[model samples]
Target: MTDSSRPTRIKVIRKSMKASPDQTESLLWGDCLFCTDAAMTDYDWVLVYDEFPRTPVGTIRNETEPLLCPPDQTILITVEPPSIKIYSRAYTSQFGTVLTTHSIRDLPHPGHTLGRGCLEWLYIKPMQEILDQKEFPKTKMLSTICSAKQHTHTMHKKRYDLTRYLADRLPELDWFGHGIREIENKTVAMDDYKYHLCVENHLEPHHWTEKLSDAFVAMTLPFYAGDPLATECFPQESFIPIPLDNPQKALEIIRKAMEDGEYEKRLPAIREARRLVLEKYNMFAQTAAVIHNHRETGTIRPGAMLKGRHVLRKNPLHALRELTDTLAYKIRSRGRRGTGTGA
Candidate 1:
């Protein structure tokens, strides 16, 4: 969809105070109609409740605040997740029984709908152009930053050791783990390398961590070790998946690619794919599209609501409040103890 067609009259409403660190109060809950300022006048919908409480109101009651433009004028898009427990409370409370949640995979049909969905990470950087300008070398056996935690793993250590053995066998093969100054530095250095080794311990397959994104952003081919579906989620043919069955075989394949210059011939295609992701899969555009779709269709999907349990005890706000109360009690008790000692 063209940028101009996207929703321009968006409004956010929230309780006057800030909510969670990740949530903006204005995006959660507030009254759009209450604002008289011209700058706030053009909003098409109002977001209610920045963060869903642990226990929301039991039912969708009329008394609950509406987060939208007056009745028919604009759409009322409620940002909710797919969890039945959360939705049950939200549906029973203020926003009414009708609700819809969407997933990141679901794009809007018409392209002008209003709603919200999970905005997954999409790294943006001019990797190809930079790589082209720098004229980076093509070398085998490239190792991107290995986190301290991964280095500590017995399996990971064994894999690294095996890779080191392979590197020793081939003199031309070079390994680099110099600390990267920034994303650009990493991207440029990665583009020069024949194959980027992206090994991670995260459970979710096809998940693109920032490091993997760096590979794509820099127009460098990746030998991914996590999530078999990682290639399916992003630009096709941009990455070479490290086989789960035989990771050593995958390394052998990478070794061949390095020696044969197959990695060099595919650079143009990888560069084009990276460009498409940058233009189409941007977080801002994706977020706006989800917001638009939700308002048009009042249905919530599995991923629309907040994921996992909202552990109240571990909450930062709760922890801070508890700490303050404990300190205050200790101070008061100390004063009383001093008074008793004197008496």
Candidate 2:
């Protein structure tokens, strides 16, 4: 490598938003993404999400490995949730920091084509709903499932009322998903549904996840409640956007779409969306794009985005209590094993 053309080493880091006060490379998610990793490292960016911060930002340079980039020379990239602070100033003061965000709302996001068997089941709710939009059902729309154990939002009562109304007045749309059902194949099951009720857990910008992507991959229109700026993520015509605030209006749109055979009409656009999503907007693709953008701009665009509270992880006491309970249980179990119950 020539003196002028030596690849700039960019080190990516992740901070535990609600827990750790400092940014470490503990890979929570979406950490390992390669921009240009061929024989020659063109982009020369390293995604160190899961790795144990082995190459921290403030390591002292040794004379033996002078070819290795110094911590200060490398740009420290922090991948964090959009709801939390993008980067910390105290950390950036030591090393150049870049911010990256992910659209992955659910873990191990629903991917793969829906199998022919899952024709009846329209949706999957493995995790509990935080701030969800009302399930807008149509005449023939059935075989839906959700797994929201609880709704913690202040307006949860209103949504519960709506569900009650549907149960009494219209029995068809009253199906609610609760608890976990490990279907044999998610793709096979989800593929059969016409729409996936993909109401996000939150309403903030850039806080999107695979709920929308899962629907697209399965060739089903996502009755989306999250991501108001859907146009920016993918083609607007691809998914059926729903009104988050107005239940009646959202239901009307869903009902009209079902009655008018809108899904069939939107098939062409939906196909295009699937292509775009897999090729460009999928989690890996998006991470690659963020890396490329950062390299081209020589920094995070418009600089660091700092400080925002996560709606779900707002309380620290809960985490502390959980940790305490886990420790206590382990200790008690060990003591019992040492003592011996009878024999």
Candidate 3:
């Protein structure tokens, strides 16, 4: 068939087959529909899942398409990795076209290279009223529940213990956990604290964990430790990033700020920072815009392609080698040489 005439396949997650007694037969279908770009074109759209369908009973190839799918009823593409080679052979022989491959990480359109989703919640309310109360302390520190994958058990224990230690050292200070419940409370608690510590575990290139966003959502000043690109993702003045080489100094500054109440008058500016996030990164609106753009354009553009050609021309290999040598030199120099974090 000509490319234009070829059938388009949209991949959707299958739901349970057991009909619900409360609904009409037509309405009783069990499937969660999260729209994907798979069926927008004549090209086959594959839904690759790490887990088996909870309701369907069959090998990936034998699975039947659900009656509730879009009217087009294009082919259902499924593959189990590790055994992906077998599925690949079956797909090529049966469909006469190679299945387009994409990683799950590739799903969320690469938002602004500034990393639009880097902040947790777009809106954080001002806590100035709460901070004005005599009972509420002016000093506070914020951190999140450490994920096991991101930190060693020992590191998690140390950080948690350190939180308690800081709390004990400053009885007037409050310690907030990184939970959905706590994030909800940030609208109030953030007003009282002078500093929010975004102590992330990993430091990957161009990858800053969601903790930075958590801090932003709280509408408090952030003392951060993450990828240097963290600053690129948000306005530079929005955060006070802790240099990897001068962690101790960063901590000291936070301690002093809390002790002296330097952050009290700065609350207005902090609230302004939070407002900027809401204006730029409304999640629902952004998601809808992405979906609409993909539908209109047919294909979502890759994020890496957004970088300037001059940036691509730079020698990453040489930079890596230089970075490795610099790291070695720092390790060897130890306390003797002054070191700084790179942006």
Candidate 4:
């Protein structure tokens, strides 16, 4: 909030922008965002939506309210993870198009990959110290890191019940690490585990968050139930896919993998996965690239088009269909105990 760095103007609208005499580079950081240490740098225009995933762009932009930035900026670079359509509509909207003179992009991100964010587990070598003390297990089975209190859907409820079942059904499966923020920092609890149930909020198309990151960093094979795009970084050999609908099937996969030493055998792929996460799938690098692109592109183009983007209003019918499909997913989720589950 220094004088040179401060925004010359400010408002709180999903659409519209107020004019400012100073065309200084501006950055807006949301307080409740998933990317705690998100990339923030000097750019002509930068907008960070902390709750982008929580809020739908089209729904919020119905009214022409003024936003928190200078009016008529060359660009309004947004960084966050939401449905692709949300970003598409935002870029094409009247206000979004105007403010985003250079670019109006909805770059979906998987939480901030900042600061050994997930790599802390491997970086600290908690498991190594335990092994040196002759206290760690020679061969561990499956383990999961549960949050203190939060479940997204009814399927989460059913999964919790199943986790309880397996806790007793197989005592060897160590499902610890709830309400232990200290353990999260050092990877003390995760090391030496052969497999990790890397469940995330949902099985999104391109929304794999820290679930896979943590597992890969710790060199543990992940029982993945998040985005399939995660495989883009690490192949199928690196992690196991868990069926969303059937907890029984997920249980079967884990049990089998651990018994036949398949988890142990996947060490090479696990090592490679860790390399990809650290090198390519880094949050700092990704955000820096977006900002760099903004600096390179200077202004907007003709006929409502941002300098590089062609602005066409999203199809009204398509918007309606997307809304209906979302509602359908929720309704069906309510009908069954084990439907549309996330980790």
Best model per TM-score:
4
Model 4 residue 182 CA deviation (Å) reads 8.1
Position 54, candidate 2: lDDT: 21
Q: Compose the digit string of candidate 4's lDDT tens values, residues 184-265.
A: 4426545667778766543345556566776777677888776656665677799998875566777788788888888668
**Winner of 1 and 3 under lDDT:** 1
Candidate 4 regions exceeding 4 Å error are 1-139, 148-155, 177-186, 292-295, 299-343
Would you list the clashing residue pairs of candidate 4?
A: 11-68, 18-71
lDDT of 3 by residue, 195-252 (tens): 6666544343444434555455556677666656655556666777665445456557
TM-score of each: 0.46, 0.49, 0.44, 0.53
What tens digits encode model 2's per-residue C-alpha lDDT throughout 1-343? 2133433333332221122224322221233323221111232343333112222223211101111322322333333322222222222333322323332221111211111111112234321230132232333442233443334332233334433433344333424344434454455435556665665544444545555666666676667766566677677778887765567776777777767877778878777776665556543444444444442333322322221212112447644543454354335434332111110
As for model 1, its CA RMSD to the true structure in angstroms is 15.5
**Candidate 1 residue-wise lDDT, 1-343, digit = tens:** 1144433454433223223323331221111222212124345543333333333222112223233343222222333322111222212222321222322222122222322222222233443453344344554346454522223212345345544554566564445443312343454446456667665433232233445656655566776665455555565567776653364686687777767766677777567655645444333334344444443433323222221123332567655654554354335434432111111
lDDT of 1 at 166: 47
Model 2 scores a TM of 0.49
Clashes (N, CA, C under 3 Å) per candidate: 36, 13, 3, 2
Model 3, CA-based lDDT: 0.38
